[model samples]
Target chain A: MALAEPKTTSQTLWIERVPPIWWALMLFLLTMPAWANDFFLFQVMGWTFILGMIALSLMFLAGYGGMVSLIQMSVAAMAGYMVAIFGASGMGDISMGLPWWLNIPIAIIIAAIFGTLVGALAVRTEGIYTIMITLAIAAAFFYFTRQNYTIFNGYSGFNLVVPPSLFGVDWRQPMPFYYLTLGCAAICYAAVIYVSRAPFGLTLQGVRDNPRRMAALGFNVTAHRIAAYTFASVIAAIGGILLVWQNAQIAPGTAGIPAVIDILVIAVVGGITRPIGPFIGALIYVLLRTFSPDVLLAFGLSGERFKLLIGLGFLAIVFFSPDGVLGLWERWRTRRSRERDPLTGEQK
Target chain B: MTLVNTTTAADRLGSVSSGNALELRSVTKMFGALAAIRDITLTVRSGERRAVLGSNGAGKTTLFNCVTGDFLPTGGTIRLFGEDVTRFPAYERIRRGLRRTYQISLLFNGLTVADNVYLACRGVSRGRFSFIRPRENDALLTRSDELIEAVHLTPWRDTDVSNLSYGQQRQLEIALALAGAPRLILFDEPAAGLSPTERAELVSILNGLPGHIGYIIIEHDMDVALRVAESVTMMHNGTVFKEGTPEEIENDQEVQELYLGDGHE
Candidate 1:
């Protein structure tokens, strides 16, 4: 069927169409950390935020730009490597060293340039070709980092980079770092929301839904897609820098093809339809990856098989909810709300 | 065989009275062995109401594509407001005050009817690439309201376009094209798939178009065409078959034999 407008005036503006349940969920996330232990808070929650940020960039590209880019993680890894190479602790210790301030901005700029170039090439193709092109580029970058010890520091990768500090606060600490990460994530999330509502964002959606018509309406579809990729890359790069600071290292393994695929899984599991889905999916993955072995050991199972269990869980979730966990939650909430007010119930 | 034969001045095309909004010179589009449009020449003057009538494969849509920059013509010159825009991109054409509506309604289905109109209006009212705020200025909203009023869609303004009936969706598409306040507008089969009453309403809307905005409408219905258009260009076999007023074309024996007469058999 041809695309039709959904009911309701405000629903058209996706940024302003937040349901009450989402707002409640967001509040719950902010206030209910009292139950989280230190390990759960620092390692599980922290990694979730970082991975989620990275996945959100892909979500934006896929959901809005209608372009699925598999190299988002590789772009993030590039940012991580930049931080490792330029941060005070990483200096010649990793590769070619540079000042922290100078390198940080330069790395981001370089990532944006690379992303724009990648987008210009990838946007020329569509569907599976787009995926393959991005994957190929990611694979090439991975091999470049793995074999080039002179620049990338070889298979062991770069380490010893630390988060910078200011105003008498050590940002790398559990609480301080969590807040820093949260702040950055929030800003990136807001930026995505803002761009999606902008004219460029609207045009991208038009192109995605119907390119032939958009072309007739006088839009350059290729240019819009490239701009979308470049914008998403900026967000992914920021997440990469944050991840490097959190882990104090960067490695070729961090951006391998398999790792890039895992990012896609996170985005799909959480919900590609919305920005927050990445965070939710990341939380689930980090929790299982961190605790699955211990939980299995208690049951007399080998920790070596933990990955198999996570894979099963991933399959189960996708089979049950193709739109992801968030879609399921949305459906369930709508059902419950309808049950409460049969007379006034309105289905979306 | 010929009917209401007129002097060359009528076909001379360019004159200062209305001034040329768009001019096509020897435009031809070829796809390997086939020429989709061949040596087509036409002039669209400001405030002209022109209908492009053609059977299937007459190159009506392809000609629209060339004018709108969907594809560059294989050879020719296209001018907008007397300036050469033959090589300009589609978006640039829009930026320079040209806009179009599709045969099938192209409203943003997820957005409200008002939002769809507002977006197009914002494109024109607010400078292109301005990212200052979520909604454009209230002045722009006021203008959009005026446009919504003009298109007779104020009642469904708040409805999501996806939820609107097919007829309403078409109206909304016209509203969207009008939102750009374009100097030239192209309507592709605007009356296709409409109910009889809806068709009449659409024709009335087209006929009532403001004097400042020139329109090029593609229509299959000759009755509606003759009523709304002051001039008509009929196409056959990928080229202009006849160019004249509705009555002159109707009285022409060759045109009638090819289409409205024995051709109907």
Candidate 2:
């Protein structure tokens, strides 16, 4: 037997653990809230990071498992709703008033189980069929939450689902909340990077590339796909919990059809091929969404024209770089490396 | 589907008292109104190399699919090492140590050569689906690297599989089948679409295969099929037409008329 070479390329290694660029970016993000304005800190970067986690979850499915799940936003929304319905909230009459310790894990577990079920239904299909199955599930969940009052509180969802007021600190405060979102985002990011190199993730990719071959190689393709959903759903659930905390509320609109597609847009725009593509794509989306309204108003256009701006931007990116922002980055890097190394050769 | 709770089967399974490694009885596959394979029965002892030869659409590939669990046979029984695996799923059949390669290379295009081989090796081992632990940490990683070297793919081990040449991909395909150290491996046209040099290399690879592992080489190349296999089973229109040693198969006049018709050499 030939001894095994390292399976991981440095490009995919847990996000270049000791890379100088990564360290520099980490330092900048860690210190942003210390000097930035409250709106800039929370509404801008904070929301970006939180939504980035949901996109990252989608990336895990699309990038590694070759699965596209439109129900990811709903999975997060479900976790968010669980936080309000199970724990203390402004809708105290509807809230069960359970302790945070019990409610949080229950929310994540329920979300994960729900995700796995969605995957089980969709895993047997591939490509467009998989997309349609997930989209249907997202649509069904949204309508169910919107119309069902007893369990989901109908259209006007439970509000004031605040972060845990633990350790003598108000977590919703700008500094505390920024740290919370940052920490969670970093953890999720690190996890996406790590798991992509992990055995389960590799097997999942193999299944994606060639399910027939993987089965012949003694792998349970369906099981791997379902397991992928469970893992991603839990991550999305965590993001949902953070999202609910960010907005301090949940509503039908949170898991609406458009929101379901937004996560897909974010994931693909980031280049679903790379682990960090979702975050990069998320940053561009949030910036366009947050700043374009003001830019539109300056041009005698209504603030609602941000959607037009976002649509135009999305089309431009997709047209030029179909693989999304990461594909563009990869092209530039390859060109630059060719100039520098001379003989390392361009990546095939 | 191995019954860990049942002590009786395990006790009987240890001694290989019977010589037959495979026994297919009256196997038939029907695609709606058409029968793809009709009443195919064949037996091969452990460590025996058999080749199935025929022109295209002769049900050779279909037979391979049925045995590998890609499609459940419309009728019949397939016993792998004395155990009935007719109803087992493809992955289950693989775990029972039945492996196969596709007519076209079915490799992981998104991963490196090393990663692809590691997946095959890791699949046969315990916890092939360990979520938390990276496969790099698996002891089989070393074996995967070794297999890559054995197939002369170490130089391209880190390269994405899609970048490799067709011949190299074929080598990796064989290496993947070998990585599991399977009890019986089914190769679907192992030398298909190869250059003369590549064909020579493939013949050497097949000829040098260890005797402990049994193989069923599906080949269009007469020289390759005859050289690598101890016996030949000729197929025609979804059924076994003839079975004999290499010399016996080469001289059969009826076999020539049916198999090597007007167009195909």
Predicted structure with the largest lDDT when compared to the true one: 2
What are the models' TM-scores? 0.88, 0.91
Top TM-score hit: 2
Clashing pairs in 2: A1-B146, A2-B145, A2-B146, A2-B147, A3-B145, A3-B146, A4-B145
lDDT of 2 at A181: 88
Clashing pairs in 1: A4-B162, A5-B109, A5-B161, A5-B162, A12-B111
Model 1 per-residue lDDT tens digits across residues B1-265: 1111122111232223338888999999998999999999999887788999988899999999898888899999998877788998876677566778887787778767766765666554433343443443355555556667776787877777788989888887787776654667888988888899999999888877767778888999888888888899999988998999989877878888877658553
Best by DockQ: 2
lDDT per residue (tens digit) for residues B1-265 in model 2: 1101122212323433357778899999999999989999999788899999988888988998999899999999988878888998998877766778889999988688888888887776666667565445555666777788777788998888889999999999988887654778899998988999999998887777777678898999998899999999999888899999999998888887777764444
* Reference-based lDDT, residue A108, model 1: 84
Per-structure clash totals for the candidates: 5, 7
lDDT of 1 by residue, A107-168 (tens): 78777878888899999899999999999999999999999887688898877777767788
CAPRI tier of model 1: acceptable
- Angstrom error of the Cα, residue A177, model 1: value is 1.8
Residue-by-residue lDDT tens digits, candidate 2, A1-348: 112334444336655547898889989988887789998888877888888899999999988888888989999999999999999888778899899999999999999999999999999898899999999999999999999999799999988889989999998988888889889988998787767767787788788788888898888888889999999998999999999998999998999999999888888888998767888888889999999999999999999989899888889899999999998989998787867745666453
